[model samples]
Target: MIGVLTSSMAIVSAGGLLFALGEPFIYQVTVMPFIALAIGVDDVYVMLGAWQDTRRTLAPEKRMALALEEAG
Candidate 1:
């Protein structure tokens, strides 16, 4: 999923920055917070995607069922 891809890119970028030289101890401390945030964001995106898929799958049948009830 795009969320997974974006999360991976974020992690890789963080690692790359850490090793690129001139990095400070404060930067190392920040990684944990950034990782936590990234994971939380990814979870939200995944949940939203699942909710959208469920809605898409159910909406048409629900509408059709309503229509049939009205007709009968």
Candidate 2:
């Protein structure tokens, strides 16, 4: 959730900066959000699935690290 929100904000900020600089986008601006959304949702699912597969006996931090590694 946090990652998705942060990425969305970063993309928006970059787009705004490009507009300010009068730089043209190669793709349509409207399509970017949908593409980002699809990618974010896919990533979230991958992370969640990885977390679920991690060992329950491990420490929380360790489990998270394992999940991230598996997800990656």
Candidate 3:
């Protein structure tokens, strides 16, 4: 969570810098992909964090049971 929060703040700062640099709007459009890529990874990081927390909370053998129970 700490790393995720720091990474997200860093990403926001970098994106803000890119927007503030006055690059051509058209050319700057290309940067959206990189920012999006970073955000995508950030999402994965959050998901893995949740997974780790869940795994730590429950026994490995209980995970499937928990998952199935949650699905219902």
Please report, in order, the local distance difference test score of every candidate based on alpha carbons. 0.62, 0.86, 0.62
Worst 10 residues of 1 by lDDT: 63-72
Off by over 4 Å in 3: 1-25, 55-72
Residue range 1-72, candidate 3, lDDT tens digits = 554565667767776786799655566565765666677677666555555545656777676565544433
Give me the runs in candidate 2 sitting further than 4 Å from their true place: 1-4, 25-27
Compare candidates 2 and 3 on lDDT and give the better one: 2
TM-score-sorted candidate list, best first? 2, 3, 1
Candidate 3 collision pairs: none
lDDT of 2 by residue, 1-72 (tens): 765786698778878999999997676577887788678878889999999999999999999999999999
> Pick by lDDT: which candidate is best?
2
For residues 1-72, write the lDDT of model 1, one tens digit per residue: 665577667777876887797665664575675675678576766555555444345676675565444433
Model 3 TM-score, 2 decimals: 0.42
Better of 1 and 2 by TM-score: 2
Which prediction has the highest TM-score against the true structure? Answer: 2
Look at candidate 3 and tell me the lDDT of residue 42.
Answer: 71
